[model samples]
Target: MTRLGVTFVATLCFACDARMQLATRTSDLDEQLTIPSDHDLELEIDDALGKKHREDLDRALDAREPGEQLEHAQLSQLALDRQVFTLDDLFRVGDDLFAYQFRPEQGLGNGLAGHVGIEAGPGAAPNLRRVQQNAFGGPDAMSCGDCHAVGGDDGAGTLTQNTYFRGDGDRTLESDVRNAPAVLGLGPIQALATEMSSELASGRAAAIVMATTAGTSVTVPLTAKGLSFGSITALPDGTVDASHVTGVSPDLVVRPFGWKGHQPTLREMIKESFRVHLGIVSLVDQQAVRDGRVSSSLYGDGPWYDVDNDGANIEVEDGMLSTMVAYLSQLEIPIVQPPDDPSLLDRFARGRAVFDQVQCGTCHVRSLTLVDPIVVTHAEQTENTASPTVAIDVARAGMRPKIQAIDLIGSAYGVPLFSDLRRHEMGTELASPVEQIAGGAPIPKTQWLTRPLWGLADTAPYLHDGRAPTISDAVRAHGGEAQASRDAFVALPDDDRSALLVYLLSLARTHKLVAP
Candidate 1:
């Protein structure tokens, strides 16, 4: 929320007769401005957003084209102008959140508005979805709530499917790859980040809480209310989401999307779906030029080559993009309350305190400040500048989300949710490339986000790679940076160990009671 480094907080939209389109080379500046190292955590917190901070951001934005600059300016300005959210604002963005709630049918594998046929794909085909790839066997590009819910939307809307992806080839795939991990206690995790950053003057989490910083970039446009990201892949046709390919591929355990497998965040996975499933692209993805794989007719334009002479049209389904983004950014990760049983609650409280004490919370940050839900103002030419800024007052505002508990869907929760969110050489023992990483050292691979631990009781079969079978097994497998924490965990007495496990389990329930 720190104005990309500016001191200014609020500014009314100013009208301009000319559409200012400015392009500046921000790559260097961006490379220069990274999450500064944490000497004293408190100092890092205080410096999250400082006037000098915005200066660095200013240099970056000023270099961009005017349009990009304006977008950067407005988004930065808006971040400052908008107040850091209270718990209530966390759920609903500009208006009542419940207004945007969907009927059971409209989520996950279903089409827009709960329509059945509208959301059809190869994943829906029983034959294609059943193939197992050992750790790699399962559907590739699946959606968030697909395997996370029970029974595909019973009246209560919990994912009942314990469907798991079978591993293929030679590996002993321990990952499930095709099941629903309940979304119970994500609130506390988000809150953890919020609490950490709240102490700093700038109030921004300086630590890297994202999956990867490899090609990360942030921009706030004047006409847009929130963030827009580019697509992950656009290959083998306009298909974006991963196909339900079986046997021939590698371990499905690499599919981190759910307890079933595949590890993709809503932000990344959804955009992929938009491109492949719906054929839509946000402004950020406009640069993605497709080649001969697709036709210009799909995008309603001449075969204008964007980057390479790839004959594919770069058109994206506009309506789905905005709505889906709205749904995701606004989608509240459920909340959890402490258990009523005194013994259980006490165990949870103690574990919670110890979780932070051991520095596990550093990597598994609790909360992240999301920019307000953005409403993209698409105009042929720059239309009415005066009233172009529209606050998205969706119906789903009343539903206030708070921390809740959920189960560690896979086997890696024992790692204290401390994930680097970057691909590390897990060694030949467990290494499997979920995504291709052609650049830099090490083989191409998909990096993963640290799994937040607000809810640990229900979600199981943890870890991005999903190699562990049980919590203890997962704990034993921790290497790399997590070794110290794992050692600390293993060194505890039986009671202490049990207490910690209990505490971890306690974090697994949803606490917030959303407005119906």
Candidate 2:
């Protein structure tokens, strides 16, 4: 067998072993619980559990009277005991879990615990003072699914739901409103970014080594996804000169998650969202505060250990956070769904050609290849061990889906995420006054990452701020590096323009519970 085949077999065997170990652990836990043999009875139990917790939550909220405050332990116990059926239970289940997390629900307490009443205002709830002082924008929305409900579940946001960021407590001024982009197909996008970053870093490192050994200045062109970031010149004395670097970090890492391409990883994005949107801090962020790496002041005016001061040091556990990331990473990429009408299909085909002709593919390059597919596993570690000795299939983490076949657009794994994952200088019209800081450096106000066009049709109210309501508006809004392409698009005849739009619309993938 080929080396690749051998490696594949070995990995498969390891994964299967991990799953078996997890099953054994799960069986042991099941033995401890007085679970019903009948499936219907089990569901009934789950519903009863959910209902009881809801009642407990209400009682806790009531206790938060003028002089009464519920402790963290009371709130923690009130959080519904998450049902674990299969290994997938370790993470989030796409069906009801997705629905529950996204859909707006009553009595679901915010990060402040049941301290603040569900209703907003100081007069209505005594704990409102604590909320107003601590929480960001005072509990902006109930669930993440609430805001991102435009095209479908986890879709883009509307103008009304625009997130006001970087403000001094007041929403009227000193804050910039940003529209939430769709979270679909992020797994492949992240994988592609990781690969591209490694390539750029390796190139710079090799250039630096050559310069130091040869005692001469060496220059390395920084490139990723066929786009040039800039060049780095290394001197003989090992002093590196990066005066020409642009878009990406001097370290050559491409962070392709946020609007400004700021977040290095999806995990970081999730952590920040918990703090900013939900006003919840992850265990990881809490540790950063305790170690004095991050200031406690940033988390708001609360207890040093428990920022929200609900007495819970950890707002969102690491395992829960990891599960959320896994759920997001596994979201299916949008697929091309051409209209059944022959005429429309023809138009879509023509528009696709026009899309290439207009050079939109230059920046929004058709597709990217993942160097390594994302794989996450959860397990316990033995004391004094350097690494985890036992592997377990938490959320079926060890069982990765088969990589999708490449499409005509050149997307590997059949994910038509049309983006080069590079930052470009958008013209003044689309530029924002607020500068996005990433890796301790401020990104240019006008610079933005190439928005992936995979699910363009579904994600309406386009552009960074949802300024453009249609795809055509977004196309016209393009400037700076995209000026020529935008001009070409503008000059196109009516039929051709319509065809291009049709083709873009075809990129919308139908929503599914799980990726096939």
Best by TM-score: 2
lDDT of 2 by residue, 1-516 (tens): 133643454455564654343333223222111222476455556644754564455456646742121122121111222322233442333222333431112212233433434433212211321122222433455456756777876788888787767654444354655788888777677677777888888778888899999999999888865678789998998878877987786667799888889897766787677566655556655666667777776664455555544445555554444455556666556666565443354575577789999999987887665545653432111121232211222112322332354556433453357777888988998887678778777788888998888878888888888889899999999999899999999999999999999888877756432211
In model 1, the worst 10-residue window by lDDT is 17-26
How does each model score on lDDT? 0.33, 0.61
How well is each residue in 79-98 modelled by candidate 1, as lDDT tens digits? 32244433233332212211
Which ranges in model 1 have alpha carbons more than 4 Å from their true place?
Answer: 1-145, 150-268, 274-316, 357-359, 367-398, 402-429, 433-435, 438-448, 465-469, 509-516
Instruction: State, as a TM-score between 0 and 1, how close model 2 is to the true structure.
Output: 0.73
RMSD of each: 20.9, 13.0
Q: Over the full model, what C-alpha lDDT does candidate 2 score relative to the true structure?
A: 0.61
